[model samples]
Target: MQKGKIGVSSDNLFPIIKKFLYSDHEIFLREIVSNAVDATQKLKTLASVGEYKGELGDLTIRVSIDKKKKTLTVSDAGVGMTSEEIDKYINQIAFSGANEFVEKYKNDAQAIIGHFGLGFYSSFMVSKKVEVITRSYKDEAEGVKWECDGSPEFELTNVKKERRGTDIIMYIDDDNKEFLEDYRVEELLKKYCKFLPVEIAFGKKKEWKEDKQVDTDEDNIINDTKPAWTKAPADLKDEDYLKFYKQLYPMADDPLFNIHLNVDYPFNLTGILYFPKLKKNIEVQKNKIQLYSNQVFVTDSVEGVVPEFLTLLHGVIDSPDIPLNVSRSYLQSDSNVKKISSHITKKVADRLNEIFKNDRKQFEEKWDDLKIFIEYGMITEEKFYERAEKFVLLKNTEGKYFTLEEYKNIIKDNQTDKDKQLVYLYATDVDAQFTFIEAAKNKGYDVLQMDGQLDSHFINHLESKLKDSRFVRVDGDVVEKLIPKDEKQEMKLSEGDRLDLTPVFHGQLPQRGKANFLVTFEAMSENDSPVLITQNEFMRRMKDMAEMQGGMSFYGDMPDNYNLVINANHPLVMRINEDKEKDLEKDLKGMKSKISTLDKRRAELEKAKEGKKDEEVPSAEKEELHDVSNKLDELKKKKETLLNEYGQKNKLVKQLIDLALLSNNMLKGEDLNKFVKRSIELI
Candidate 1:
């Protein structure tokens, strides 16, 4: 027997290994199993090169858990380490045996997974003690047993062994007894080794006998050895890809389509990227893309490996170039990772364009599901936006689709405004905004359905991309104002009449929760609705953007601003104006005359004092001007009070205001009830 300390600069190595070597102690299983696989693959390489004259029997790795013994063992039938080899590799900390072997057999060795020497020490994270019983393949070699008990001190001695392989036995600590559970071991194997290059057996296969599961004689192998991503795209059919997608995500709906990524040039990257049917809640679908290193599952959080928008996609991405154990910041800053991300973005754009150019009907059929991803890409990645513009589509309220250029051409002749800017009319809800949509269509304009969760941000992106183009909601303004021409019409009511009518409409406005409406007059045809409600495109868009993005919460905090546009030419509005003049004519005329006299005197006093020093102006004149201003304000208040009183008495005024509120989906609860009763009385 020989006793020695592990090669380390400090005596606190074991503590560091247990607490800081790995982010999660569960990864110890992955590290040990991966090492076993490396040994098995090395044995195959040696046999092929005639370096070892032995039978290459079954190379399956076995993992067994013994609850009674409180030990978990991972055994492999492969090239095992001799005493001298163990002394050099195991005793010397941070010395990777796989790295040495690969250096020696660089031409013949297959891909090795371990590059860092710290993987073996990860076993100490969950073990109270660990033992390595190994027998080298060399002729006339004896088996060696190595043991360590949570310390730098280790024991090595000769032992009898029949097989040419290695066995790693971990005596699980009391704190980590869960590792002794069969189901837990099986689950770890299935997660990390499901697609490994070597077959891994956890325990015996089970069978349902008399409604109870029983162990069978067969081995329960948990790995595929060769997944679909490792094969060529030519060998896979569409159904095969879909089958693999189901294997990855059993509960998810069938993906809209897939992109078979098989690139070997810039960096070795292979996987199938499925375009899943994403929901409006983007956070729920994020981190679904699993990233693997040489077929071993590394992580499902692949934010840095792919573009931010492409993270919405679901599938597996296996690449040997990505480091298995590194910070996300390092992965994001690595040049190769950036190249891989760029390549993936390009491939996705290319595939969509191919589908669109070859079979546009199919593309259109899938557009509703595909729009969210494309819009996200366009809003986030500039390169993706440039490539995706050709395939990005806009669907009208009539269920017809068109590309950006195609829609522009169709509407350029009529939708172009007086400033030569083309207006793109869109509606959030076709049914809810049916009146506005019909008005737009009546004016020979098309209205698109911009109802996606990300449409607000996407519209702003398109405005920047499309030249001389602007997007306007169908309910954003009146149909004529949405695409205004050079011709202007005069309002039927004078400014004074309009101001007087403002109080009448304002008095009848409902108490909508956190909503503010401004009464305004527009000259329209008598056939139009007497009153219509519209929102400003910019403010509404800002509020919508604030809902999706940060740093714009101030916009969301503001109340929704709406315009109550009263068409002066409409019969109801004209009648209301006539009624207002008849009811408040006596009181309004008296107040107006008084206010006019006070205003004239104040203006003369101000003109008399112009360009004079403060001392040169008379104090009595200043006091008189102040009185005149106060009297003018009081007369205006009296006029407003009389108009509001008249407006409250007039049932027609409340009916018109309620009609406008109902059109905007804002009339509800007690206000809606009152409006209904008032509407019945008026009828």
Candidate 2:
């Protein structure tokens, strides 16, 4: 028998191991099972190198729970430890007094025991006492037993055992009695060891015989010794990858495609990344990609390992180089992690490029489902953007797909303005912007559907990337100004005529939710609608962006700015302007002539005061100017009121405004009903 305090540099090592070394106490099962697998792997490696010349017997790691005894046992027929090895490896935790180790990680408890190659100590987390019965795989080796009762002291002694293996028995603490449950242990095994390279068995296979279930002689193996990712890519088919994806996500829809990542040089990394059929919501699809270390499941939250934008992908990423237990910050800054991230990005880009080049029809068919990923990548990662631009597709409103370069080539000759800037017109809603889209189509221009959830931010990113190019919403402005195909048409109406006729349409503008309408006139073809509404691109994009990202909520709070543009050359608009002048000219004439005289006097006073200081200007002249300004403002208001009354009486004014609103799908409820009733009578 051997009795001695476990050789530890710190007296509080046990407390630190049990309380601070693991973030989740339940992960102790993962650590212990992982260690068993590691041992099994080591034995396999030795046999491959011809170091061990004995029969390579069954190597299944077994996990059993004894309910009555309140103990959980994990046994492995692998490279078992001798007494000397137990003393040297298991007892010694650190070379230093380890005060620095304690001090450095005293406050932070996220550090896992497995991180320091001390995974066995994690068993102490849930155990009141742990027993290890191990015998080395040697001809004359004797079995040995080591026992510890959640303290620095441990007892080791030789024991009789016929088998060459190790068995770890953990006496569950009173507070952790749940570990003794068969269901609990099975769940932990499936979570942590589901895809381990070595076989893992829990309990025994059962058969429904007689009236109920009965245990069979066959072992109930729980793990897939060879998951699909561990195999060579050439050995896997499309169906195999899809089947694995389904295995990972039983309830999810089939993935669009997958990229098999297998790289050994510089760092060992192997896994399958599936491009899931993402929905409009980006957050719901995150955390689907699980990270593994040498087939041991580490974390599904792989934000720091994979790029943040790539977390939407589903499946597994196993890399032996990545540390099993690491702080997110540490993982983000680690050089190996950075290399792995870049490699993954390159692999993804290459895969996408291959698909796009080989099967363009398939790529186009899947473009809608695939664009969100490409767009998000382009928006977040610069290198991804550089690579993705080669295969990135732009979908048009007519349901056609074109690569960025292809679309640019098609539109550069037609959509480029005199300023030499290529205009990429897009629409959010095809049905709502149907008129604008048709107008653009008629002008030999194309419109894209930028309806994805990420499109707002992606549009901003593309504008910055594409040289001398801009993205305009199809309804962002009048068609003439949107592309400026020809020299801008001169406004047919004078400024005074436009100002005098503005109140006619302004008075009839219907109230919509948080909508601000500015009545303006522009010259257009006589065939064009007399009135149409268009939103400013910059203001609308700011509001749309505010909805996607949270920082610019003030833009969201602001009213939507719509320009109620009147086609001055159209017959209806011309008639309306002429009628407004004919009806209100006599009434406003007297007030206008008096206002003109007052304005001229006020202008003379403003010019007189321009070069002079405020105090130097005569007080009598200031009073005359102030009086003239007040009278002119009063006269203008009265003239505007008369014109407003005329417009309210003219049903044509209300009908024109409603027609423009209806064309834009903004007319609703009672206003639509009145427009319908008035349209019948006017017809």
Candidate 3:
């Protein structure tokens, strides 16, 4: 036996490894297993080059846990390290000092490890002591035993003969004895090594012998050596990709479609990206796409490697070029990673385009499920937007799908406003906006369903991208005003009469938040709803955006403002106007005369005091002006109360307010119940 100190400038190497180098202690299994896979791959490369003459039989790596012995072992039959090789690779710690190393990589622990090749050292994180028993493939080499506690000292000695492979035995520390359990080790292996290139065995296969599970001699492999992504597209059927997806996410609904990513020119990247059926609020399940380095699992939090939008996809992405690191930003900014990202985006867009061109009906069938991803891509990636324009689908409330050009063509003649801007009408809720949708359909217009989580931001993006086009919510205005033709009708009511009618209708409406409603009149076809509640497109869109995104939180904090648009052509509004003209015309005129006199007196007092100091202004004149203003305001109130009384007796005013409230799906709780009862009585 021989003993030597580890080649390190500082004795603090083991402490750093245990506390700071790796993010999680459980990753030790992944690191050891990854090292085993690398050794196996190296042997395969040598055999391919005709350097190894031995049989390459059963290249699976085996993991076994001995609970009684408190030992966890990872054994691999591959190219093993000889004594000299072990001295160079394992004994030497590569860093100047712990502080300097940490300062250089404080923000990104993974970058330091990935760049400097620290895979083997991670084993020390979980083990109190570790032993490597191995025999090199060289003919004259004997098996060697290397032992090291969590320190800078290690031992190397000759051992009994063994196969040309390595077995890493980790004596689980007292604090981390959970690793000695078979289930714990098995779970870690499955999570990190499920899609590795080499088969990984956890234990012997179990069979239901005599109605009880009993372990067999055959190895129970945990990984698929040849996942669907590794196979050629020509060789893979659609069902095969879906089967693999189901294996990855057993509880999820079937994926809409998949993009097989295989590129070599710019950067080596191979993976299958599945478009999941994303409906309603888009909950970002981070780390859904596993990033692998040469088929060994590195991480699932591949935010930097994959485009932010493509993170919604689920599958495996194996690339030797994408270095595994905790700081995804560093990985993303790497030249090879950037190239790979661009290539993946192009490949995704191309796949969608191909599907649309070849089998449009099928593509349309999956559009609802695929819209969220496509819209997110277009919203985030400029190049992706450029390519996806042709294939991105617009789904209408009629359960039909169309490309941008197709939908624009369908609605151009009927829905274009007087300014020649093409109006693309949309509805967020089919049930809630049913009235608006029916109103649009009544005018021979189509309403697309822009209801996805990203649709708010996406519509804004499309408005900027599409020329002379605007997306208007179906409830944005009365159908006639929504796509305004070239005509304006004059309001026939006097100013006094308009003032009288304002409070009558405003008094009956329910108040919510700081809601402000402007009572306006529009001449429309009598068949349209007598009252329509509409919001400005910009404000509504901003508010919708605020619901999904931050930075515009000010818009979200504001109350919803609506227009209580009363149709003048409808009989109910016409009768209300006629009643106002009859009941309050004289009183409103008298009040207006008094108000004008009071305003003149008050203006003169203010005008007289313009250049004068407070002492110079007469108190009598100020008191007289205040008295006049108070009398004038009282007279105006009397006039308003008379009109409000008249309106209260008129059920048409209450009916209109209720109708508008009901249309917005805002009349709820007891108010909704009252509205339903009132509606039945009115009908």
Candidate 4:
């Protein structure tokens, strides 16, 4: 027997490894199994290189849990370490400063992950004592047994003859006795070794015999050894990718399509990214992109390695260049990782462009599923947008799909207004905004379907990118004003008449929550819609953006203001004016007399104080002016009250307002029911 202290500068090594080396206690199993795999792979390499002249026997790595013994053993058939190698690799902790090492690599679960040659030490996290029985492949090497009891000290001695391999045995501690359970060990193996290249044997396979299930003699292998991503794309069919998707996410919906990535020169990267059938809630589908290093599972949260927009995709990204650590800091600084990200972006854009050019019908078939992803990429990645601009599609209300340039060319002649601004008409809902859509269509113009999860943000981005282009929702304005085919028509109604009608309509506006209405009269042609509801584009966009993002919540809390545009050229609007003139002519005459007298007195008082400072002006003149202003305010109130009374008694006013509200889909619940009943009663 030989004895010596561990090769380390400090005696507090065990405490450091126990408390801070790994982020999760669950990772102990992955480390040990990874070490066993490394050993098995090394033996295979040695045998292939003529270093060993022995039978390349079974290369399986076995995991066994002994309940009564409270021990979990990971045994591998590979190049095991001899006594001297054990002393150097196991006994010697080749670390400079434990604190600095832990701090530098703490965030990265992969940095200290398979490093430290201390894959064996991770056992100390869950074990009270760990024993290693290893036999080197060398002809004259003696089998050795090394044991440690969660301390710096260790015992080494000769052991009985065994195969040329190593068996790591761990005695589960009181706090971690759960590792001794069969199901727990099985779950850990499935999590960390499900796609490992080597064969991992957890336990004997079972079969359902006549009366009950029976354990068979066959060893239960937990991993695939060769996942679909590692194979050639030519060998995989569409169903194969779907099958692999089901294997990765059994409960998820079938993916729309997949992009097989196999690049070597710039940076070695191979994986299958699936365009998941992303439902409405985009937040729940994140973190599904698993990151791996040489088939060893690293993490699923690959925010730093992948471009921000690409995070919306679901699949696996396996690269040796990416760091293997809980903290992904290593990848954040790796030049290779940056190149890999750029390559991935290029590949995704290339695939989309190819799909758009080759099978546009299929692309259109899946546009709803693909729109959000394309929009996100365009909004976030500048380079991606450059490539995507050619293939990004727009489906108009006519159900025809056109690329950005295609749609621009088709509409350039007709959609460009007198100011040379290219107007892009769009509708959030084709059915709800059907009236507006039809109006725009009737003008020989196209209206796009902008109903999407990210369309609001996408339109904002598009407007910024496309020069002289403006995205106008179909319902944003009246048909003529939407494209501004000719200069805006002047309002024919007199200013006094507008003021008189404004109060009448304003008093009858809806009393819904935070719902304010602005009454505007447009001299649209008689053929145009009698009434239109237009929301301010800026305020509406702010609220839509606020729903998706934070810090703009003030806009979300503000009232929803809409324009109650009454077409003055329409017959109903003209009749409303005629009725108002006949009903309020007498009241208007009396109010005008009172208001004119007050205004004359106020003008005389103001003239007395003109060109004079407050100290120079007489208090009597100021008091007289104030009295006149009060009388004017009283007369205005009387006029407003009379207008409200006229509006209340007029059915044309209520009928027109309700019809406009119904057209905009703003009348809901009780209001909608009342509108239906009112329509019946009027008919």
The best candidate by lDDT is: 1
Q: Tell me the tens digit of each residue's lDDT in model 4 across 1-683.
A: 77666776776566777776656777788878888887888878888899988997899999998888989999988888889889878887756667767666645645445442666677888888999999988898888999878766789999885688889999999999788888888888887778888999988999999989789999999998999999999999999999999999999989888999998875689999988776655654568998877787777778777889899899998887665543221344566678888989998999998988899889999987888888889999999999999889999987889999899999999999989999999999998899999888888899999888789999999999999999998898888788886666766577777788887887678898788888898888777766678998889988998998899999999999999998877877777887898877888988888888888888888888889999998888888888889889988988988898788777678888888888888888988887788789889
Better of 3 and 4 by TM-score: 4
- Each prediction's whole-model lDDT (CA): 0.85, 0.84, 0.82, 0.83
- Tens digits of lDDT, candidate 3, 262-295: 8776668888988888866676887798887767
Q: Against the true structure, what is each candidate's TM-score? A: 0.92, 0.92, 0.88, 0.93
In angstroms, give how far residue 117 of model 3 lies from its true place: 8.5
RMSD of 1: 3.8
Worst 10 residues of 2 by lDDT: 324-333
lDDT per residue (tens digit) for residues 86-134 in model 1 = 8877887632343353244333222323621356778888999999999
Model 4 lDDT-worst window of ten: 323-332
Select the stronger candidate by TM-score from 1 and 4.
4
Deviating ranges (above 4 Å) for candidate 3: 98-118, 209-211, 325-332, 490-496, 580-633, 676-683
Ten-residue stretch with the least lDDT total in model 3: 323-332
- Check candidate 1 and list the clashing pairs: none
| lDDT string, candidate 2, 1-683, tens digits | 99988767676566776665566778888878887887787888888999988887899999988888888999999888889889877876663444466565534423543332367887888999999999988779999999999788989999998888889999999888888888888888888789998889897899899889999999999888889999998898989998888888999988998998889999999999999888877655567888887777788888888887788788899886774432211233477879899999999999999999999999988888898888888888999999998999888997988888889999999999988999999999999999889889988999999989999899999899899999999998888889876677777888877877787777787777888999988888787788899999999999999987788999999999899998888888888888877777788788788988988998999999998988999999999889989998998898788877787788888888888888889988888898899999999
Q: Rank the candidates by TM-score, best first.
A: 4, 1, 2, 3
